[model samples]
Target: MDYLALLSETEQKKLLVNFSLMTDSSIFLLNENKELIFSIQAHNAQEKDNKSEIDIVDRDDANKGKGSISFSPNQKDCQRLLKDLYEQKVPFSCSYGHNYSLAGEPLIFHNNFLGVLLFAYPTSSTSIFTSQMKFLRQYLKNLFVCHYEMDNLSEEVVYNYEEFSLLTEISQLLGGILEESKICQIVIEKIQKTIPAKSIAVLLKEEKEDYFYLVAAKGLKAKRLIPEKINTQQGICGWITKIDQSILINTGQDFTSRNLKLIELIATQVGFSLGNIRLSKEREEILLGILDSLVATIEAKDPYSSGHSKRVSYYTQALCENLNLSEEVKKELVISALLHDIGKIGVPEDVLLKPGKLTPEEWKIIKNHPKRGLMIVKNINSFHNVITGIYSHHERYDGEGYPDNLKGEEIPLAGRIIAIADTFDALTTKRPYRKAFTVTQAFSIMAKNQGTQFDPHLLDIFLSCVKKGKIKKIN
Candidate 1:
């Protein structure tokens, strides 16, 4: 498709000069625009060309140069002749002014027109031209076709490499994503760079929903209003058709084929990514069932702690929302809160339900619950992030809490946020030893241990949420 654009000017001029030299016939090369790119005068037309200082007017630049015949053959007549010759698309014989006879041939590749080549000879040399014209025309056509094929091959290589490389990068990126909508957004954005579609959209169907929802939509033509949801029967096709009313616009058949292939590969990758996400969700649901059973056992053992983990999860989720955390991270933090006290399952029922304050010997066993919770779920693959909040919920902010005594920022963020939620629920809920602290009293108590027991910034946010009624009060 590049024609002479991809080649350097020196290379194009050298090519034309060689053709003129080898044939000993004056040659003029014009691109599809009818702009005279090169004009070399060979011995055949030299004497005639020298007779007049010819001023060939350029259609593009409005500058005057030599060669081609003239208001006196005009750019309009020249353009008309080039167009007509291309339509015929074969070597055409014609008179070049009154002094010389010329023949023109179309340079073509795969039914696509590249440009036209014109050879001129003096009228005195016309008798010797018929045989030379046929040979020279065919030779020039063959040469151009060969050059065109090479260009096509080179272009295709670069295109394929870029397409493969882009798809590979996209594949690696999609591998790490788990959300269905996120996968669609990422995949569609990559497709935009390689495809020439007017608009692109990824529509996904949920198993229980009768309509397809638009996941991501983009492109120059994408600004047009598109429905957010479409029923399955909305112009949906399951097969390819070859009807005349088809929406396909083929700018280049081969080029378009390659582009379509790129789209297909990307679509397949997205489908695989979506499939992986669905499977992951399925696995996660199954794992949550197991974690729920474990939490139920712990709650059943200690009635006072009933609904404690669930309340903590609710509060943690509220904090995540107020913090504007990403959905994925928020989801992890919430799950971690629900499973934070699961280690109590390993504590003896007599000690856990002891109706009175425990001694230091019993307190030592209570402190081991966080580490025990870690050991319980540590083997589970999907609960890796949940383990942190489970282990550190009891750890204080200063270097004085729990098995690790991690100071300041050494604690995981999930642990830090869950600590505030866990403490708030504990303070608000009734325990065997004392009545529940009112919301006002709970805040007053937590406010005193801002940095030593809780992260100061996070505690402030918790207080803000309660003030804004984002976290509902128990009192």
Candidate 2:
């Protein structure tokens, strides 16, 4: 929701002032981005005098006219304290001396972590003072959540059916449609419904390009004709592109302030949508790069399993497509399949490469791979959605699997899909102990254990796909 961007500098300052006055403690407010929005001294003159006597510089006074102050928690102890507060998303207090105590509360709005609000106070204060402050913090958090929700509701209520419809159309259009020209057309058409203009145009600047190209335009008279290419210094659109601002010119009729704000909002959304498209591509590339590196490392350790993960990923994706899974589900399945065997990296080389039957102890070690893979990827926030698949891919349909014996629909869909793909590849591809099986041989083996080892329904779909020549081969 871009919580930090929603609060104006003045609003932040006012909040700091109110917090200081109410708590009688010096306060520091930092946005979720860890940027210091502002700080305020205690409203108590006696405390201010005491702080002055101690020679602790009041950054608040020094930056009175500034929009925001960039103050780092330079001390290692303070830094660690802030890190704990951020990670825990809870209020914490620490004492530096008999009299001095530092307390921090994370500011949250609508379940979104917005920032941290730190209070510096005297430890000698009454217990009631601390309790009252805690109550106030809770009150503030609830107020912020309510305020944000009300603001959103107010925005929704402001729009009539036509206005709401136009916004909805634009939002849906911008969601997955990344083509710049198409997006510009949709945005312009939506805006035209609300604003009567002689002409409306969308100009975009390409990466590393010096000029803004007019991508979409409507209702242009000869006198109001826009140039095909606009210089960086030309026109309102050029200036907007140059500085990333949304400007509106009122020429045809008296547009309400709400209407103008809507135009600006649409412009801002357009810019954000374009930026997201680029970021999405970059994120996909980075995800693929990480997957390749991890898969390559796994393949390197097990020489006979080269390209095994990739093939599993391909097969899993094919199975997902055949099942008519959503794009998001297919993406996670592919990632989970590529790294399904990643836990084998932790198994002893001898255990992994053994050409004969393993001892019970060695087999146990092999089973620990899923748990190890979970540990390896658990810290990565992006992998949280797929970690279940990595950890439970070996689980059986009848609850006989390792790590967690989740049965039937209790198992995550990604995990269930990967289990089929993993077993299929293992049976069809030559492992150190066994020769590769033909497609028929693999299917027959899998079908025999369908209700026990695999989801019978998914297995049926997979076998049907293989028979139809949709999935070519395990390799």
Go through the candidates in order and give the C-alpha RMSD of each one to the true structure: 7.7, 27.2
CA-lDDT, candidates in order: 0.74, 0.76
* Regions of model 2 farther than 4 Å from truth: 1-189, 195-204, 208-264
Number of backbone collisions per candidate, in order? 2, 0
Off by over 4 Å in 1: 1-134, 165-177, 186-196, 209-211, 218-234, 238-255, 323-328, 398-400, 410-412
Model 1: lDDT to the true structure: 0.74
Over 215-333, each residue of candidate 2 has an lDDT whose tens digit, in order, gives: 89988788978778778777675567577654556666767777777887787778888888778778879988998999998989889999989999899999998987777877888
RMSD of 2: 27.2
TM-score of 2: 0.55
Which number leads on TM-score?
A: 1
17 Cα displacement, candidate 1 (Å):
9.0
